[model samples]
Target: MSQQTTETTPARLPAAARRGGGPPWMGAGMPAEKSMNFLPSAKRLMGRLRPHRLQLIGVITLVVASVSLSVIGPKILGHATDIIFSGVIGKQLPPGTTTEQAVEGARAAGNDSFADIIAKANVLPGVGIDFDRLGRVLLLVMLLFAGASLLSWLAGYILNGVVQRTVRQLRSDVEDKLNRLPLPYFDKQPRGELLSRVTNDIDNISTSLQQTLSQLLTSLLTVVGVVVMMFVISPLLALVALVAVPLSVWVTKQIAKRSQKQFVAQWKHTGALNGQIEEAFTGHELVKVFGRQREIEASFAAKNDELFKASFGAQFVSGIIMPSMMFIGNLSYVAIAVIGGLRVASGAMSLGDVQAFIQYSRQFTQPLTQVASMANLLQSGVASAERVFDLLDAEEQSPDPVKPAPLTDRHGRVEFERVSFRYEHDKPLIEDLSLVAEPGHTVAIVGPTGAGKTTLVNLVMRFYELDSGRITLDGVDLTELRRDTLRSEIGMVLQDTWLFGGTIRENIAYGNPEASEEQILAAAKATFVDRFVRSLPDGYDTVIDEEGSNVSAGERQLITIARAFLSNPSLLILDEATSSVDTRTEVLLQRAMAALRSDRTSFVIAHRLSTIRDAHLILVMESGRIVEQGTHAELLAAEGAYHRLYHAQFSQPAIDVDEATPPPAVPGAPLLRQR
Candidate 1:
């Protein structure tokens, strides 16, 4: 590790202009629009169902059995009521003479009204009600129903356990999928929408599945079993109850269609809100600095308003479904009642049959509503799954070819052979180009703002692939080597640096996790940042991260340089290494860099231009093509493009007479050898 020296110098780091930051909770670069099929994502969600199948089946069995038990008791109670009343009334009444004799006696007494009342009193002689027999029967039935309820509750506890655990696994799986997805897939999605899928969508499914699966089975079993019992009692009454199911279904379908789009819109608006909030958090200081606080607030207000409308629309419309189903269900129940009652009155059905048919009619409509409610939740889950799976299934980082041979030894040789590439295929940012740098040689590339300098470096790093031709390290084609193995042998100091949450010691040691504390301190001292670290109250123990309210650009950059110094790769890429520092810091950074780059193949892209005057070889690029190459003295003698650009800088040290700067030569003009 090398130390970079830092002097107390004032300077400004360049501002970043491209990133949108993040949207609220989703972070930055979430997708703005949705794509991908809901069906595929849903099919994927079904795979989660497979592991919970046994519990699912158990829940189904218990709920159905509980519902079946519900119908059994009422019928058994009715039979017991009838039998016990007959036995008690028979015990109380004369062996042969029934309540009919009392009615005849009353008629003989010439009281017509009393005669009718006496005839109506059958259970006990001259009394209208059967109290003793009925009370005993009612008591037994109540006890039986209470016991069945106890069993139902016990089974319900088991189903609750299943619901919670199943949902937990599903949530974990969705998150695992997101983690496995490549960086580019997240680049295309909105964070808020993604969150909704993982949270709201999965929640919807869990809630619906738990309630609907358990109750739907119960309602369905009750409806079917009760109808069968009704048929056993009187088939004519059972037929009347089936006629109303179709009408209830039609109502539910119409309501579900209206609410579907609302939920989708709700998800989208929430994403936009999330995006706005993320931007605010990342740039809160900027908002104040630029005096754009009002603008940001207004934008947020609009997003909130839109979110409010969308959320209300979805919830309000979906809420209507249950009540509407119930309304239709009520009307159907009434119609069944009238028809069943008429059948019973006409001798086509018994009283028990009529009672059961009414109960079953209610049962039939209840499941219909349960299913409709389930559909709403299922639709939401499916929509969310669509968004999440789009990311999960999208193209990811391709693994290295099987059994790739490692680079024999980089020895710091890099070459681009007739390379042509574009980020967007047709843009052709880098046209057919070729270049090479040998071990221990310094390659300085200088270019105008969009002259494809960074693109060249990106290709070398394999962050993006070439559309044509190849890049090679140590004469081995880049694609032929394992990406990890190749990259591990290289070190980089990027213009932008990030520090994770940890102590300064840990941050430096991050360059190589196995590095001892002594090595970390040595590396920091080499980057010239050790003096400041020692001044801090905690020294190496000082914790730093993005959230750290302290730590400036110069401090961060020095630490990064120290990290690279510790890495000590044979091939080094320093991109605008000292671009962020003041003159004093730059000079110290340059000293540290010189120590680090010693005897290594270094590619330095310097915006300062002054820093690279000592490069062993300088390559000048324009419009993606290398147009100039030579030592400082040779390029100055030629008086070419390098010469012109070198002279254009506002500040320059008095150059060696042979050093590159305009006049006798023009950059890109021609190569010349001078003795």
Candidate 2:
């Protein structure tokens, strides 16, 4: 069967390009082929359950006991029926018995209200009703039913606890797994979709465990017990009842086969729809500005319609199981009744036996239908389980070296030797790069947008490892240092500022969690964040939301700067940190940055030529190499890439570098010509 593939949004980049991790459905829905195999997934799920074996054993034992009690109940009721029949036949009792007499008879059976059962017999001559025996049998059957009900309830209660615990553990494992996953793994997934796996998929598994697991064992036991009881009562009657099995199986198989694809479709479409909703809402402002409301609605409707079709098809088809199975069961019942009647008339089978067998026959078909119905639910749950397991099994971040060295002396001398890297293997972004940043040097990196400026800084911070060669900090290999230790020595503020929901003070002191109130205030004042916070209604205590939407872009950037300042790291990275602010705010930010960068090795990725002109050493990158590297004055004198870039940004009409005389290099520092 042809499967529908979810279409990606044109505005959103491919999952590989997305830095934020999310559900796979955000980029593409689960492939139809992936969900076709449930065994491997099922096996993995069972492996997870191994730790709770003792609890499961207890549950299974309880289920067995519960099912046994219920299965034997119908026969006990048949004995009560026989007692009633005997009483009626013995005395030729009236066709209609009064409700009062029934109450009296019941009272005489167990309650001490009636001293003599004969007085309450209520039968005519030639045969006296054995009221005592009849009453006793009735009481026994009632007790049997009561016991069965109790056992069933007890089993379900225990099973609920067990299933809940299992799912709880599963949730914990998923959360821990997400923590260990690499940034590259997240880059290829949608954040919303991953959220769905954590919240929605696990919830689905929980629901299935509660509803299906409780009954699954008991139902199977019931079918087996009912079958054995049937054969013991009468093989011929058992044979008649058994005929329904094949018919029921055939019907269920046919329906389930047609619906299996629909079920997979239902899940796939659901994920796709979730992705669209997430994308649309995340870009709500952009959609409005572009007047794409109608377009958004149209896209949503298409996805909705697809979901509706898949859901309806799955439900409508699986919905056929119960009625069809019932019809077959009813037919079997009529066959049993007709055959048992003749055998009873011929004294081949007792009336009680026939009645018990009929009840057993009904019990027989009930589980068959139930198992068929649960098939759909279990499939959906298993599919969900597979996705969760896939996430848990995803590649984790490279392990930290054992006994990793710490930055004992935080002088911040950094070196890159023959480094090579690429986000995508074939498309190299940085090639054979080498650089030296002496302690306390501000190395400004300037390039065109895709010139791998951020990529280079990513390598330095060990967010990404080099494809070849080594990067060292303070004469120690970075790879040998623990990731936490490396990151602790460095702080970064990206072009995209992220602030958690918290007060201004709390956000500033985020990196230095134990920062004192005075220290926090000092950092905020240093970054000019105090200037804006004091204007707010609550000053430093004002609360921000998840996205910090309540604060202006420039203010949010300033808060991030304050956070970086509080960290007081030996190395700092500022990637377009001032891009969001106005010129006036940028000047204030620059002053703050200057103070922060002093006596620290900082890598500044800047697009503004003016901001980086005074940098100690400006590295002008083109394609994947440093085309020009020197002090700003030297680069302007060379009249190379850096000269052209500076002139293009700050100078008026494009000046011909060939016509202009090259400025001389600064007397103290000469440009290091690359080979």
Candidate 3:
């Protein structure tokens, strides 16, 4: 299928693309076919084979053998029919021959002409042909057919079951890979497309297994098997039979080329539509608040129109192949019939041969058209595979070269040495910066907007690499630690709390799956989650909706905080929002934070300077650089950026940030330290 170049919203393009999007064809020459290789997905799929290989092997073997039996049975029947019809069973004699004469001749008791006697001896009587043996032959054929059919059904059931389990296995694998994927892969693709690979593509492949799928390999094998048999019957007739093969192939190729493109368009549009719906539904609250029902509907309608066009084009093209093939098949059948009949009359061939040829022709056409549609599946699978592989291909943070030095005591000494970094090198987010926090001390990062407060903590947590500097936790470089181990070593509380759909206990246990029940209870109590848990009808077992959509924001935050506390990491970073909870809940949360942060290396990114006034160090950052570093007492004495920021926030009842209050972006705030 020819691809139509889509013009993205200019605003949405990355800076590099925004400069020109591309020469003429944007993202062209890029593999329109998904991935270049299937090795990775194959390897991943094969890994699951260890557990299911034996079952799969059994199913595959049965399917192949059973399908072959089925196919062979029909050809055998057609051949047998030809044999029966072409004078193999001469029960009745030629005209004018009497049955009594034949019996008497056989007994040598009748006086007749030599020719008459010969006819009588050679055939059964003219009118009274026996039907008994024919019935038995038919019964035998039926028995063979029934057995083959039963085996085919059993094979189908087994293969179908195996395919279903395999799909499940694939889904789990993709999901696990998603968790491990580097963030860049997600940045380059859409979520709906990824969702399609995990859900839609696997389903498509599984559905094909319901019957003998029209996969190219199976269809080719079946066709080849039938063709070889046809040749065995009559080489000349087989050559004649192949006259229409090329024509059928050409027709299929045309249809397939057109259909493949349409199929791709159909899927792409479906993903776009799905993305729109997902976005709208996920942000339903924002939509309601803005009262933009019509706006959302218009956006949905636009995507729907595109989807309809793609669907109509795809289905219409796909729908044409069968009828077109059938038409050709009919023509081929008529040609074979006319030619075979003349040849038979001329003593060039037997009637049985013509009958079998007809069966062979039908087999070829059905699978040819069926095989044509299989390309559609293959293309779709490749598209889905490409998306999945893109994720698997993303660059991960480099593993540490040296084993991280394990520290016994939690000495919260944090230091940044000439740290400098940027998400994009051309646009520096955090320029040269440095700071230190003594053990047993708290560090506060304060910035106006894009000042890099969060970036500071991000660096502290080793979420990103330092461009030309090193960040050390107790004198150990952050990069010299296992990612999972490092992450587990630090606890975090963020402004946006995430919760999965599950019972309260499950969500809490997500942080520490191995935690004891008593430990969970203790953590819940510390974070003021006990009250909400007790209030639920089912207490801790009360289930939440996806993303904890069923619960209040405050409660969700508390649950997340409880999880962090339960972790009990040696180091903690809290990007606390200025937003407040209920007075009672606030008091409980403050007490919880104090307890959680006590004696641990703590970094707090906060706008409420009052909250972090007790920290041992207060570093104020601006324009990707640290402007001041000191205690509240020392900073208040310095009368610099920290003093102005603290006073500016409290000076007026309503003070607006000039040129927009720059909040941190992801890896937010340039940070107080370059590292």
Best by TM-score: 2
Local accuracy of candidate 1 as per-residue lDDT tens digits, 160-221: 78767878887787777765564334434444446666776667767755665566566677
Q: Rate the local accuracy (lDDT) of all candidates.
A: 0.69, 0.77, 0.66
lDDT of 2 by residue, 1-675 (tens): 000112122222233565232322234333332663666766776676778788888888877887787878788777766666546554553345553554465465774332123233333333445678778877877776788778788878877787788899999888888767765566556565677778878898888667787777888889999999999889989988988888888898898778877877776677667767887787788788878788778778887899899989888898888888888889999999999887765547666788999889888888887888787787677777877877887888888899897678888999989998877676777899999998889999997877878778878877666899999999899999987788888888877778888898878888698889999999988888898888999999999998789999989888888889999989988888899999998988888889888898999989988898778999998767888899999999999988888878888666456667766778887788879
After superposing candidate 1 on the true structure, give the runs of residues whose Cα lies further than 4 Å from its correct spot: 1-41, 70-237, 336-360, 636-638, 652-675
Each model's TM-score? 0.77, 0.86, 0.81
lDDT of 3: 0.66
422 Cα displacement, candidate 2 (Å): 1.5
Model 2 spans with C-alpha error above 4 angstroms: 1-33, 93-125, 653-675
Worst 10 residues of 1 by lDDT: 6-15
